[model samples]
Target chain A: MMRLRELAHARTGDKGDISSIAVIAYDPGDFAFLAEHVTSAAVAAHFGATVRGPVERYELPGLGALNFVLHGALGGGVTRSLALDAHGKSLSSCLLEMELPDPQAPPAAP
Target chain B: MKTVRIGSGAGYSGDRIEPAVELAEHGGISYLCFECLAERTIALAQQARLADPDAGYDPLLSARMQAVLPVSVPRGIRIITNMGAANPRAAAAETARIARRLGFGGLKIAAITGDDVLDIIAAAPWKLMERPDETTLALGDRIISANAYLGVEAIVQALAADADIVITGRVADPALFMAPLVHEFGWDMEDWDSLGRATVVGHLLECAGQITGGYFADPGYKDVADLARLGFPLAEVRADGSATITKVAGSGGAVSLRSCTEQLLYEVHDPARYYQPDVIADFSAVRLAGDGPDRVAISGGRGAARTGMLKVSIGYRDSFVGEGQISYAGAGALARARLGIEIVRERLLLTGVRTSELRCDVIGVDALHRGPGTGAMEPAEARIRVTGRTDSLAEAVRIGNEVETLYTNGPAGGGGASKSAREVIGVVSTLIPEAKVTPRVSYQVT
Candidate 1:
């Protein structure tokens, strides 16, 4: 179960629109797996419709982790209509799904 | 019994490290926190293994808690401390043993670890965006030790478990005091205002009566009645987390605004955002009020969300350092000391043995008097300390032996100089990041 979200009129004056998020995964290891799979290109495609800036890496030294910083996303210039799943866990699921290898199976053992 | 009291028992010597027990048995306080770790304490403990295998553990640390732990277990008096350095589980097991020896059974002992992060620096894939010293770390080898300064939740759980003692690794100084306020008051984890009050209390009592006059010197208390019987601080916290700091009767030292302020600012920078594992307490919001006779009431503190990860302490055997000093007496002794330094330097250079670092100082000459003046120069001597870093002990020993040659070949005796200088064992300091560390906990019944 996963979901996406949309906030139209919630604006933070002069400070840029704040994006509050909660990233969840079933297995604790999957959180790390998703972070590893979601490269800059993958992150851009996930939020591609709206954000128009560079993806910077967040070095979380304390927690032994990293986060991708999505810069210049909310300034009113892209497709605002975004689709979401039911449980709001879609973002992390989408990132995790990218970790799955292509199903073509190397053109057969025959 | 006084309305408010805070402090450790001063008379208890070694093997009596339990400040909390003394405070409760005699001081009559509401809250108690025992602070045992220092910046280089863990590293020093590691090095002490070479001298004595059993020196790793502070034996006195356990004896302090023997008396009050049983009394506080049922009554719910909280005890928090960083007594779990290097080996927390062993300490926890020792506590349990002490409890059972006293016929206190079924005591729950929870050991909270995961604060040691020395290994994290090695496994880290990326570098920190910023460092305190701004020095670029080339590899993980730079770290010597890593221990996290965890919050009081683990101690709080141990308290909730009806444990006789809550043993923990190197938690923040304030967390030891804060945990009880959180557990007893049942304050919300995110409640900044309430947490701030607890934080303020922790700061006031962290140094054990530092709020009174342990560190600060007051004109009125220059000769505080009894120096030997000084009292430690006791914090009586309210439901809202506001606390009053005071000491027991018949104790030495005076608590005043000046003294409390001096203790508050000690070893802390940026009161606006003092950091811990849980919250960034704003010390600026706190107001200190002295109500006379060793009582300081603290209120109106605040906090912000924590911003960064906790840093750790690390150490390792990088090199050997040996220092030798010779005291020269009578006139021109300082000149002889200066000549001694030149003699050692040139000799080492000639022998093709360059030391990693060398420091030499001539005391009593320029120290008591100015430059080489017309006056009778006092008895002085040159002290030369040479330290070398090498994988081989033989090489370090060779450098130490080289010091004797300087005496005969160099300038003769000034005025009854000391025989030889002392050898200085080197203990290097290193910082550990929070990610690579964890504490291990265990227990046993005495």
Candidate 2:
């Protein structure tokens, strides 16, 4: 339900190590909620890494959405760890899986 | 049921029946496309960046979002569009955002980008060959927007990703809708004939409802009924990418040879060979037959092997320009407007500044006697508009200032400066051969 931009941020490390971590919101409105509650510091805390620089936010008018770009990470060998050939891998899918949360538990019946 | 296609423009307005939309709703259409790029669009996108650096995607897609998504999705009608002028990624994101906001969160959106190669033009290894039409291959300098008109590959990829919406930038207009159908139907990628049929469908519908009646024969054309509820065409290709074109029923517009052929020549430079990123579709073999008042059938499309290269789009710094306008009233205004143009041109030349392009037209006054012909004018009033381009704003300003002189003792207005000058920028497009284009695919999910 959430726009891709609103739920994500991506940045590459000094050696071109790409690391992105975002909290996928289920509802479009919930993106605003995540943006409000999930601070960059919180994200850095979750990843156990130092906040490299100010998170650069993007309000994509053309796309009618928002996104942020964060830098630096605790470790840099995510791609190398895969050890899979680049042509055969779908990194975007892997990254997306990491960013999105499993379905939340249903609320108790009233 | 037979296949039908329709094409429209970028940033569609649901306020009326866009031809493409109309065809899809009323006529039994199978495909819908909208070609929204022009020389001015890149400039508009650039200026939009000035307003908001993240404004590369076309705003017009918003118009198509609410209207088409609900109906098309429910009906299993697939849609493809190139409303992603400068940034397909942003366009796709915006589309998904709108869908989610509207409670249609299940829709998956795919954005195709990285076709822009503005940075590497200086060192690209391609020959930068010239076309037979005397258009030179873009040098590192002359390039304004060098976006490769991608074929249907990315669209196919999006469909493989199970995306509900696919947005692309500067794709060959026909490929917008063709790629998705071919992919969804599991059409063999190597089946050139099937690809050609899909390409034909895309071409027919690329101009939206033009395959309907927006730009068709007069008198019989139902401008109001047709105009009020335009249709977006839809194709129902199966595993072979061959399908029928039909709308959801009870929409406006009629699909016929008159309408379809009119759209065929809209921006056509060559009828024999229509160029696109995937393959060269020969329009000569395309056959159209009027099945009914609201149905047009198409088939017999052929395509040559695709050249192995991606077209690249590169935009860079270009000269600035501005245009000024003034309206003259009373007798002799038409003649005066012409003289006014001459005076301005002469003055600018005398000052030793040359403009890249200049245009002059006497609108109302010229319309008076000749009924739209350029001839000896019998007065009334004149409105003069002059467009001049220069690298310097100073030179542009001088050209704008001379208009007031024509109005004073020269043409008609009360002298002194009568119009305002605007700073303009020149935009030119060139194609980069495929060898220089490299796909920059990045993946992420949120």
Off by over 4 Å in 2: A1-110, B1-34, B39-53, B70-79, B125-145, B217-229, B232-253, B313-316, B349-357, B364-373, B376-381, B413-446
Measured on C-alpha atoms, candidate 2 has an lDDT of 0.52
- Candidate 2, position B80, lDDT: 64
lDDT of 1 by residue, B1-446 (tens): 22223343322123234445556766655545677765455655545544654444445566666766765655555455566666566666667777778776776666667765655644654333222343324433544554566777677777666654566667877787788778777878888777766787787777775555653442332334554555676767778777777777666777765456545544343455667766878766566777767777777788876644665544433444443445554566667667776776676678766456554445433222122231244453444343343334555455545555656666667333332222222222233433434444444434
Q: Report the TM-score measured on chain A for model 1.
A: 0.43
Q: Model 2: per-residue lDDT, tens digit, B240-314?
A: 444345443566666654355444433333344556677766555556565555666666677777766554433
Model 2 residue B314 CA deviation in Å: 4.1
Q: After superposition, how far is residue B214 of candidate 1 from its true place, in Å?
A: 2.9
lDDT (0 to 1) per candidate:
0.52, 0.52
Estimate the TM-score for candidate 2.
0.65
For candidate 1, what is the lDDT? 0.52
If scored against the real structure, what TM-score would every candidate get?
A: 0.64, 0.65
